[model samples]
Target chain A: MKFNVKIEVMLKPGHSDPEGETTARALRELNYPIESVSVSKVYMVVLEAGSKAEAEKMADGMCRRLLANPTKDDYRFEIRETR
Target chain B: MKFNVKIEVMLKPGHSDPEGETTARALRELNYPIESVSVSKVYMVVLEAGSKAEAEKMADGMCRRLLANPTKDDYRFEIRETR
Candidate 1:
């Protein structure tokens, strides 16, 4: 079966987000009343696996091995069968 | 009222995704059977607006003004009430 996975990777709280802060500043400068902005990365991947359980395991492994930084980032993913 | 807005910005089809390509190659090297990977940016913004309609308008303006590139990127957003 083919599984489509969506993964979101975000920095843990207390970490400074320069890009988001800069973005917010730019927006406020443009006269939009905004409190704060935070940014994250989303990954959409397509892969082959035998079953849903196997696909979930593979997705988890991918996150641990390559998608996120253990010390600084938190990541989660959702999987769905693809035609 | 305060609104939490989630915005996603992605490269439109036909644009090269060097980051996604490099990530997929790294995952494959680690022995994962992955077909393709595409990455997008997600922004979580908190701001004050008079009502849902106003919040939506503000979010849309943000996307149009800075969150996405008109020629190469597509963006969508979701807004929800927050304490």
Candidate 2:
């Protein structure tokens, strides 16, 4: 079976985003009235596994181990089974 | 005026994604029958700028400079004006 998963990782509110800040500064240089912006990383994965339950368990482990930092950031994921 | 922009940055096809690869390996360890997966970053920005043209120009510049790397990545952005 094949599964499509979309993972969104975001910094917890109040945590500074230097990459976003840098981009905002560049926007100002380009003459934008940008005040604030929030940026996060998104990951979409498609894979084949034995079953939905098995896939979910493995995918969840991947997130907890590497895809996300449980301390300062939060992650939400959506999984879809492909026909 | 306020514009809502969604930017999706993807690695040029054929580029090796170590992060994705690492996650895949971990998945195998977790007993998943995973074969392959692709991962990329997504950024959504909401900002207030002077005008549509200026906002577009600034947003474009920001993407070119920081939101994307000129070498191996391509980006697609959508802009919407908020009432």
Highest-scoring model, TM-score: 1
Clashes of each: 0, 0
Q: DockQ of all candidates, in order? A: 0.93, 0.53
Candidate 1 CAPRI classification by DockQ: high
Misplaced by over 4 Å in model 2 are: A50-58, B50-58, B80-83
Model 2: clashing residue pairs?
none
Residue range B1-83, candidate 2, lDDT tens digits: 88887778888888888877886787667665667666777666778877777667767877797778878888888788878
Q: On residues A1-83, what C-alpha lDDT tens digit does candidate 2 reach at each position?
A: 88987878889888888888886787677766677666777776777877778768767877787778988788888888997
- How many steric clashes does model 2 contain? 0
Candidate 2: chain B TM-score equals 0.79
TM-score evaluated only on chain B, model 1: 0.97
